[model samples]
Target: MSEKRIIVTGASSGIGEAVARQAVARGWQVLAVARRAERLEALAAEIGCETFAADLTQEDAVAALAEAAATFRPTGLVQVAGGAKGAAPLGETTIEDWRWMFESNVIATKRVIDALLPLLRRSTAAPQQDGSASYAEIMVVTSIAATVSYQGGSGYNAAKSAEKQLIDVLRLELFGEPIRVMEVAPGMVWTEEFSLVRFGGDQAKADAVYKDVQDPLSADDVARVMTDILALPGHVSVDETIIKPVAQTHPWMVHKGPLVAKG
Candidate 1:
């Protein structure tokens, strides 16, 4: 039996999927959660981790997920099932898009955390001889957009920023507990669906986001960081980390083409 059990959201694709794969490789009992049953099933068959399908934004779905997860007694929660719906300026963005953004990014995160926190607490591992206990963890995958604002990114920026703030406060609220709250804010990840979905399925526009950029961050790159952090002793908490490609200094400050030495 695996020593640790972790709940990874967004396991249907992208970063969450990558994290689940790596966690399983490290001998973790992973409850891979996502909305798509097929993808989660495929992952489970290939990697031998369990899967749960749920749309976290729905109250009934989250309640159901929490009840199911309680059976496994998860020691960790990884919130990564979030996205950007549109790339319009604040005035041009529709209220529908804004609502979706908040619901998917911020509200979904809150719902999952609220419902599953008790399970995490109950599953805390025994303290080791090194004076460190294997504490429960809550790791969120925020974005660099959470901290940096750009034109036409108002909705995503606000929603992600709010999500980051929620994680920040959660760390404070759980100060005396053995629960560790953390977040990884990545910049310019070249995921297959992120930009495409943000641009509303415009392939060309999504392609343009990474056009000529040399080696943008990949899902595996971010996942490596997340898993490595989780592997650390429970006494050590990374708290917060921001990851980005060298070509991406900020949302608007991406440098296309190769990086050459300046004379």
Candidate 2:
């Protein structure tokens, strides 16, 4: 639907899915990428968008993810596919699980950007003062966990923090260029799939995650904000925006008094 081309990683669910849906609504041509082909296909169909199925954890897939942007000549990039492998208590956490979190989230993201940079660069070569766009921009969904962590999130937190730093370096390096990079961190949004993905299909436990917070941010809420950020004029580049639901305050705090009591 968009006149401009865009690529969204982790397009299967969560913030990535939300961003893609929002982009399509604004008439942007969307390339939804994710490990889950079924979900991506359904999303693509529903939004009249394109899709690519790749685990992104595999080296070959990461390579494909980066280069895939070249084929589409996307003007936008959204990296949202990421997860915490296991939530074992700190001492019980294994290197293997930690690696899973880092590789899938950090390493894969780097590889894809490495491959896609050339294309993104091409799109933004000449800063667009003209109506036609010559450069592209990217939006990456990070977690509040990157800055702080839950008791069992030692590994996941580190991985996101590392990713965030990498992008910070990229921004400094790309200051003169039109290829913009941004990060959005959401504290807690009701992605429906969030707990399912986090707890790995434990319906009861997943449901309990939000039992206290009555006004969780719906996926639509995040999608709307992200869409607004992207729709901003190109002259302005948003480095990162951190957001959290009112029910959830900070990493170490929770304000679940009561919805009726909440202002």
Candidate 3:
């Protein structure tokens, strides 16, 4: 089989970084994209994967990223760059926060898709025994909040929900084509920078989010799911997957302590 090349966005930290590491371990070629050049450099040095530093929210940056990625000829795209900015009540949330969420999650995703479509098409693999060709894939990382509503999560919920809609429509639009469009929604992933960034660098506030929670999902946990999905036969598509830790039943509901048998 020929080499498989994949482009992973938001590869500087958290789940994105973990995905890059795992994908490399599986002997796949990766082009890791993010805004932090220094971090990307370190990841590249450690894992032997190519890295590109570009802010997905910037038009010029994304355009440049697409150009560079074309040279890599990616067979798949894993988008994990978007994040929540603030967690405030609907009325109390700043308009700026909502706008940023939309731009980063929704608009940025659209831009990357539009920019890279041609290259993805060019990278389609050979036909299998079933007579179905292994086309390029597009995998997006959404949030459980997209489908489940919760207090202080309206802004993020709106953004990720819109992103989910975008992916759904994209799949429809790309129907009859060989390309695969997939989405994964994760709940309660306890990453170092995620809650910290959402809470504006308040360590205590971030710490409180996972306080007493037994084994909240980690970056590696989510990354493993993502890589496993990518490893499936090209003819098989896992359209939508929802991943949550055992402690988390919903975005607003999490079991804080160890699990025990019911009396």
Candidate 4:
């Protein structure tokens, strides 16, 4: 039997890295994609998987990712190769900010999936022996901010919501063929890449973003949930998942658990 092929995007850090690492450990052949060559190389070395250095924001990059996928002929894909938006008041928003958010979230995802359509189909057509399931999974990592309104998130919410809608519709379109579409929505995860990228290297601002929320869910938490969803018995599919910290009531509300003030 051929080893299971899994493709993970945004695999350089955060939830993507965690999922890629975990999947590789489960005897799955992982194709990790991200723009940071050094990071991807280090991860590929540790996990003994293939790595591709491509910025998902570029259409060509997505095409390259698809070409790489064709070689592996993967049965699983985790679309975690997108970026989050920074905190900025609506009135103070820049045009570039809006463009970057859409490019990274919506366009990038569309491009990569479009390129890998054939691979996904192959997985659905293949058969597994010994009662093991050989199904294809296309999972997207979205944010709770897309569903709930929050200040300073107009552009970001719109982009994520668009992708979420696309996935929801595609889910229905892909039914009855063994191909599954799912989305994992997370709330207030504190990861080094996420915080640094969203805050644009402003450590102070990023630190404050999570200071009020006690015990915010880490990237590992989300990864565990994702892996569990994949490990379920045959014919059991998790369509949608929402994960958040206990203290976070919603997108805008944070319960500020006890903590010493930072000077």
Give residue 163's error in model 4 in angstroms: 1.3
- Which segments of model 3 are wrong by more than 4 Å? 125-132
Q: 1-263 in candidate 3: lDDT tens per residue?
A: 55679999999999999999999999999999999999999999999999999999999999999889978989999999999988888988999989999999999999999998888877774664466566789999999998999999999999999999999999999998888899999999989899998998999999999999999999999999999999987768999999999999989899988887898
Question: Which consecutive 10 residues in model 4 have the weakest lDDT in total?
Answer: 124-133
Count backbone overlaps in model 4.
Answer: 1
Judge candidate 3 at residue 246 and give its lDDT.
Answer: 92
TM-score: the better of candidates 2 and 3: 3
lDDT of 1 by residue, 5-62 (tens): 8999999999999999999999999999999999999999999999999999999999
Task: Record all residue pairs in model 4 with backbone atoms less than 3 Å apart, i.e. clashing.
Answer: 10-81
For model 2, residues 1-263, the per-residue Cα lDDT tens digits are 12478888888887788888989899888899988899988997788989999987787886776666667887777888787665668788889878888888788778777777777777765545555556578778878988887887788789889989878888888888877789888887777676776676888877776777768888778878888988887657888898888778776566664846536
Task: Give the distance in Å from residue 63's predicted Cα in candidate 1 to where it truly belongs.
Answer: 0.8
Instruction: Give per-residue lDDT, candidate 3, residue 36.
Output: 94
Candidate 2 worst ten-residue window by lDDT: 126-135
- Once superposed on the true structure, which residue ranges of model 4 sit more than 4 Å away at CA? 131-133, 259-263
lDDT of 2: 0.79
